[model samples]
Target: MIIRILFLFTYLLFSAQLFAQVIRYNTVDFSGMAPFWQVESSLIKDTEPDPDEWNALFDAPPYQILMAGGFSQKEFEQQLRLAFMPSMGSLLRKELDKNNPKSNFLRHVMQIMGNEKKLKELQANLQKAQLIKTALSMAKELLPDSFLYARALPPVSFIICDKAISHAPTGVIIDLLFSMDFEAYVPYFIAHEAYHFYRAKIKVPNLPGHNQPEYPIIQMLTQMETEGIADQIDKKKFFLNRGPFAGYEWARSYQHYLAKSPQAILQLDEYFIRMATVPNSDSKIIEDLLPMNGHPTGYYMANAIIEKMGKRTLIQQTANPFAFIRLYQRVALKDKKHYPPFSSITMQYLRKLEQKYYLPKKAEQPKQKSSPKLMWYEKDKVINNW
Candidate 1:
């Protein structure tokens, strides 16, 4: 027992050092999430905190994601009401009230910070970051060069989310509240979200206007494509092991639906085809229409596209996502039998999309042409579409 304990301690000590070098721990963004939550929850009860701190926080990298993500105090509160455990919400606020003896805002912030949990996650993310960086560094010159390589390493922020996780154009946010082995699958989650961040930097044209028939379909496709790229990045490009993501294990729990076919997997999205195209259709209408009986339609289409294209092309597709759709269409031409029925639906609308957005008439194009980004995740509303 004594020898085992000693060995475990040494292993942990070495692991900690390895993490520090692979990816630097960034607390600035996460630390702000707490105070920002206080500001939102009335926990601190000081809506009138110093203007300077507010301005600085809004300006800060850690907090800049809020604005970049289009999340406001009102929307965040709504999410909190929906996402947070009710007991914890009430308890945390009461503990943080000014009259409480233990109401040090910073101290209370630590409660939800998940410091120890985050530290373990830090190790996982570091290993992932190292893998990604090493692969990119080794293959940077060998691979096709693009604007993605020109960008700096995106900062990672750990926080509590009602949802499992999300990434913004600015950074990746991993939630500690999902109640799982935050470390086991964190590498994949980080890589997945990081790819979202990376793709956001790419200057693709926005999907067709909301009223356009093509809008919702493309939005769904782009999400799946983004997920596909993230999935492939860690799995194929870097060749990293899943380690402990529990995805396969979770898949095992559903014995009722064994080995679902691609065609069936995509049929789920077809339920929303009309609803998504309708002007001002409620988002909830399509929410129930997730594919694979549970996975989003994006997951299925993205996998099909990625499997057909392979890694090298997929890497290039990050800079030009239109290529994914175009390439998928070409594959459909050659192998029409395997694609889902929705492939036909997309093929019908894609021509209009390419005409309206990608190949607009000269009169329709912008003057001082800044490339349009795929603004699906942070569309017209303050909410995150993903």
Candidate 2:
């Protein structure tokens, strides 16, 4: 029995050594990436650590790399070097700034973990193996950009991890399951957050009476606006066959959600009606849960205005959310044929501007060519153009 135990221990130690020796890469192939984007992975293995400590030593690199040919440690590092330039200065800065507020925040969380005897218990609940696998799958599909462009400032970074937490570099880290599912919902979610980010950066003005002063109300309204616009874009693009996915369910759900607010309904009717008249009107499903007391109508209208303006204009005009509103009101008022009594007159000019500049051009189809002729030789005869 003693000899058997000793043999098993020896085997375990050897296996640990093999696992520890595995090299992981920290770079992404950007050559084939789209304009202003490159995909990156988050995990990499360390070399200096003892074999038994491999799991404890897995570091989240700034970026992850897809290796070439083999999964061996040497190939991993070779691919890493090919894809990224490691800056000692950046590393030094990150290390030295441990006392910064973000770092402090992380420190506080770490302390909490230490004090809460249940920290390990919670960690165990996370199922790290499952999280890592999910993250790997997401990395394969999303092809997330390793670097952000100067002009393209994403408001929220979708992170996949075991726990639900927020980090400075990572943005929001939900369970790896949510992050994996994010691929299905990301187009709309990204659009929504991007609007809010643009608005914050530009200091957009809030509505008069609707100017949010408290927490839930402000958060709710902001979410409504962001999500509403995202839904509109998704519907329009999808219906026209220009977007990643095809469907109108998400867009209708957004409209329905917005209509639930009475205050928004009173202010946004005309806008919604206009949106409902857009190319894919049948896709919108406004429930009869609320009467036409202007509240529900107003909510849809607001979304329509944002939708009509499109993302480029939204980004540019986001300096003042009020400006967009004012512009929308003006255009709504000027359309004598469709204008409501209180609609702002700037609508006409905005409409003209949209007609002149905002409409997206249709994608061109590739030209077709005639099929090529083939030649064949049989055992006894030669055939041409077969």
Candidate 3:
């Protein structure tokens, strides 16, 4: 028994050493955020992140992005309360100021619910900067002119985003930089965001200025263009880390579904286009999106764009979302043999946009403080499409 125990211990240590690449990460956010999650507690049993669990997570859809449907079993409903509003910096400051064990919202979730394990895992993993370095290296190799390589990877401040990883890298946010369960694939996530940052800095023609939001359909197409290009860039490197299996699985499954039948996704695309360009596309369609969980799944469009454009051309249109959607139609129209017949209406709409003419905006979106602020092309319509 003693010998067996020793062997297991040795193997575990050896495995960790073998996988621990020497890399560094900007801890400004990691450090800032760690203390809030690292507090001591007695009500929790520590559970470690399983590197093997991402596939299972992907098997259930919401976990792919929203981290929903009990996919994590750890970070779902209970976790959402932890981040309903943007509170990372404020949260840390509050914790420090109060210093009272009773005052921390995270403590209630951690100790009271036995989820301190997830928090601890996040704290422990951020110290391993090698993964960050790996993510950056992969991005640079593929797109040598990446924002990360050009200006160096930015400081990533980790925060809980309801219950999933997302890139909201505006001003100083890093959108929950690393999750323990998904740590190995941190680079893939980084590379995706790196492209968004890079693409944002790029000035392309006919897009709205920073001060003004682009039309909803145009915004939808832009998201597809940028995200599709980012996927093309970061996807090549994920096999090495085995981190983004769920994400890749999602993209593949979406593409497969579209190949077989595209009615549903195309419905979403048409809805968005009408919202943006057609004066008569009923704004009431906004209510229909509530069923979708978080606006239409732009990732579907992202997959379609990548599928239609091929890797080389998709990469080339990273900054030009307008061109990206146009190319998707161009490719789809060219491949009529493999694809289902296009709705003549869709075909006609494509022609209008291709001719650089789009329907005039109908009624503009109504503004209200009660409603959550929305990005271009959508209000807080769905729960999962992020």
Candidate 1 ranges with C-alpha deviation above 4 Å: 1-144, 159-166, 175-180, 205-207, 211-213, 234-243, 247-261, 264-296, 305-309, 315-323, 329-348, 360-386
Residue 234 displacement (Å), model 2: 4.0
TM per candidate = 0.49, 0.32, 0.49
Pick the winner on TM-score between candidates 2 and 3: 3
lDDT of each: 0.45, 0.32, 0.43
**Model 1, position 206: C-alpha lDDT score:** 50
lDDT of 1 at 369: 75
List model 1 lDDT by residue over 203-322, tens digit each: 646556778655565565565556544544343322223333324433332212323435443553364454436535554343344443332233444556657766565566554435
The per-prediction tally of clashing pairs is 0, 22, 8
Model 3 misplacement above 4 A = 1-28, 37-108, 111-125, 140-152, 159-167, 171-178, 208-214, 231-261, 265-279, 283-309, 341-386
Candidate 2, residues 15-67, lDDT tens digits: the string is 22222133221211112111111111221221232333322212221111111
lDDT of 3 by residue, 271-312 (tens): 656744675765445434422222123344455555766555
TM-score of candidate 1 against the unseen true structure: 0.49
Candidate 3: pairs in clash: 23-129, 23-130, 216-377, 293-382, 293-383, 294-382, 294-383, 295-382
The order of the candidates by lDDT, greatest first, is 1, 3, 2
The candidate that wins on lDDT is: 1
